[model samples]
Target: MMDWRTKLLDPTPHARRDYASLATPVYRGSTVLFDDQKAVTDDWRQADNGYSYGLYGTPTALELAARIAGIEDARETFIVPGGQAAIALIYLSYCPAGSHALVPYSAYGPNKAMAEGLMRGLNVEVESYDPLIGAGISDLIRDNTTLIWCESPGSVTMEIQDVPAIVKAAHAREVSVALDNTYAAGVMFDAFAQGVDVSMQALTKFVGGHSDLLLGSVSARDDVAYAKLGPIYQQLGLAVSPDDCSLALRGLQTLAVRLDALEKATLQVARWLAEQSLVDTVLHPALNTCPGHEIWSRDFSGSTSVFSFIFSETVTAEQVVEFINALTIFKIGMSWGGVNSLAVVYPELERPGVDFGGRIVRLNIGLENPDDLVNDLRQSLGSI
Candidate 1:
């Protein structure tokens, strides 16, 4: 008879079993010892043999990377200190001096900043285009254009991009596409299957599921992009702490359960918000009223618990503050993908490039009962 536990623990032929009596073992160290002199010399080059040094990767990190790679159905995956670092590593690897990259206008705020600040400093040109540009992106691609970046159901405005159209446009121009998939995580969308060259996520969010660890992952289709990014990642000297990787691993075990609860509760809350008299618009891609609902429905399997809504003109700033302050369940905080519900008010529109205005509120639906959350919001709105 076969042991189920052994099979589960070592799913891959290359994976070695550790007898440690823990769900996931934490391995931490800076220097790794070799069994022999030739082994030491050969290990220095690493060259696909596992575990060269602690910083290169520990068993803890490799286990998490393997799990993520398995989920993405990709050849390889690498962990970074944070989500932004994962994005930066890709840029550093593929985009060289004088190269141009196109990014979605509504992409993550910090990602936009990276393209504007650091990418420019590296002599790379970063262009921000409308997420809905779709096939029109072909017009924007120049000879130097190296990459087209996309973020489905953009972070702030939550607009679902026509990914296939954009991918076709970019491919015609011989450009690679990178998507910041933090919002949908891997549960809702398959980036590789959607023709994305690179898929990245801030594991700190839904993957961590506890709002505790800071981690990020980048998955690539073939060895080309993965090989290109690997050295840069190692050279950058970025590594997730063993403890954080272990936490993310634990979070992955329950990701299916957490995301299911969040999806159900978030939709309920979004629908209620849509009907509220004090709401002018709800910017959830999962809702049919959103701008790119058709595209979202077409490309994505599910939506995350995060979304935004705009208050009606009659709702004043004072009232908004009153509503947020009066909430008993939704905590006012930034960052999401946790078991607890959170609420935050953002400038109605993004600044400098795009503006949705200042009347918008972002919500992260948690594991709380949908009825209780609705009641809290109703009471808070009544106070306003």
Candidate 2:
């Protein structure tokens, strides 16, 4: 038999038929049958076959997980309710009470919030560090440090972290590394190959390119972490709907193509934004002027469609609202990685000492015409 990776990428008959049916059939069930009592007992122990119970996973979810694992070059994959749950699972799996964790300062808002609010209450020391610390992270490791969390081209800030350097630093101290790879969506970066122990993604964004489903996946480099987390994941009763898994599987089929188009168009728009008098700087990893572009270029194969920019002039909340409301092509929404373009303004809710300036706008480029997006931005900026 051919390698599953080759089979997954190739336009083979099996691959097409997997979803060729007008709609990916949903396998809804809470119980699974076995041939006999002995077989059921064996399955209940998870000693044989690919599945045992609905929460453990079904054929539909398994197929999606296999495809994602193949893409990430990981040993196993676990599908969770959403991205935040995936992150939470990693924390819950490894970080015990009285443990310490290193999290990027500019990571997704929820991630920071979880580390600060929930983990802190649990007696876990979650320290926020600069994402650019890279190899220097060795200095931050403590006896209780158990996990180091990273996010490349961070959510709203779009700061690219030096993943390899940080991974090397963490591994030296026997610390596990987890990356919020939702931004790059595994298209740009390979977390496992970069020495990361586990990789997590919000399939809701890129993998579910249509943005019609909410799903998250955690891919473990080897069985160590998988074996440790699998039981916990099962115990938590975390499971994605078979329909959502099927949708994510279908989205994976065309992810590379959709991401290619979106990334190219996004870079074009970023360049145009950089040239505008209203813009102070374009926060994109692909740009040579970005703070961590060298690391991004060295560690990543490509960039995602999402990026942000800072305005030259500080604009009021009302002005920001007007700018967003004036857009014709870009829709005002929360999450990105959809086929439709999106625009959102990041409010100035910085940490006490962290000054990230005032006017930062994040843009999620879609499969839309670049010229039209540029024109829409021009009009919006003019209105502002």
Candidate 3:
């Protein structure tokens, strides 16, 4: 009895729908339907209250958040646009305009950048500290100190932090501790069990597995932390794509298998590199030569594929570029945790006192056979 246009806009389902599939449905929408006017409300606590709006997350994103929370044993997890967004969320949530925070010198570069750029502009004082400082972090805490950040087997240099010691020091001062847990994939290390207030990961890496997506997660260890983060998350509107969430779900299915294979192949390559005459230091946490390797052994259940090694002083920075160009299988690029191996030289990489002087190269071992990867490295090193 209505016009065809009216029929086309009908909200009723046209097909019988009792069927189900193992895959998480890719739910995409900007609007959510309410049963009645009384049921409509906007709340970001989708895990507890029913989902209110698409910006908070449809079912797809909620499922990914739930899975990450389960893996980390957290009270809740918030899905964001990328790993950087997760860092911003935690900073904005805990470090107010006038507060002070502590971060390891070896944290993800963007994290330090945020500390100097955005947080500084907002009047927050973020101080970089030694990754191995451990309980000494207590001395750095001031009356206004609110957050302490740890990144184990840190960015390029792979300096592992004494997380439990740092946590104890911060808790005594009634300060919060947050960790960049992306290196561990929320599985290799237990962030919540270590007494961290929040644990964040770049799901783009291990959780997405195939280098096909960009996503991140910020998880709260308890209800107190959850209550602190939720409102800020809503205000920021850090929504993620449902398609990416579906890929992450698929990645989770094979996560354990992929990790097992990656660990074996990576250790093989790292050990081979450690023995090479051209290599000065291999920064794999599983190896004893790395800084804070003892702490990593105590805190981590396993190590993953990405790590770095420094060229012996005998090799010049220019030769590092030549070495990267000579590689056959290990492609020259940045961003790790994928199906393909990667190598990139950090000519300007430095700490407070030590300088790599363009001689450090970071590697992300892929699913390639260990022999082939080792051969690739050998030939490349020979060229240098």
For every candidate structure, what is the RMSD over all alpha carbons to the true structure, in angstroms?
6.7, 7.7, 0.8
Q: Estimate each model's TM-score.
A: 0.92, 0.91, 0.99
| Candidate 1: worst-modelled 10 consecutive residues by lDDT | 39-48
- Per-residue lDDT of candidate 2, residues 1-384 (tens digit): 899888777743453444466544677776777767776632322323545788767778877888888888988888888999998999998899999999888888899889888899999999989888889999999999999999988777777898898999898899999998998896578898889899999999999999799999989898797787787787788877999998898898889899889989999999999998878788899897677988888888888788888776666667777888899999988899999999988777574375545577889999999999999999998997
Clashes of 3: 1
Return the clash pairs for model 2, or none: none
What tens digits encode model 3's per-residue C-alpha lDDT throughout 1-384? Answer: 899999999988899878699999999998989999999999999889897999999899999999999999999999999999999999999999899999999999999999999999999999999999989999999999999999997899999998999999999999999999999999999988989999999999999999999999999999999999999999999989999999999999999999999999999999999999999999999999899998888889999999999999999999999999999999988999999999999888769998788999999999999999999988888887
The 0-to-1 C-alpha lDDT of every candidate, in the order given, reads 0.85, 0.85, 0.94
Off by over 4 Å in 3: none
On a 0 to 1 TM-score scale, where does candidate 2 land against the true structure? 0.91
In Å, residue 27's CA in model 2 sits off its true spot by 1.8
**In model 2, which runs have C-alpha deviations exceeding 4 angstroms?**
1-25, 42-48, 314-317, 351-357
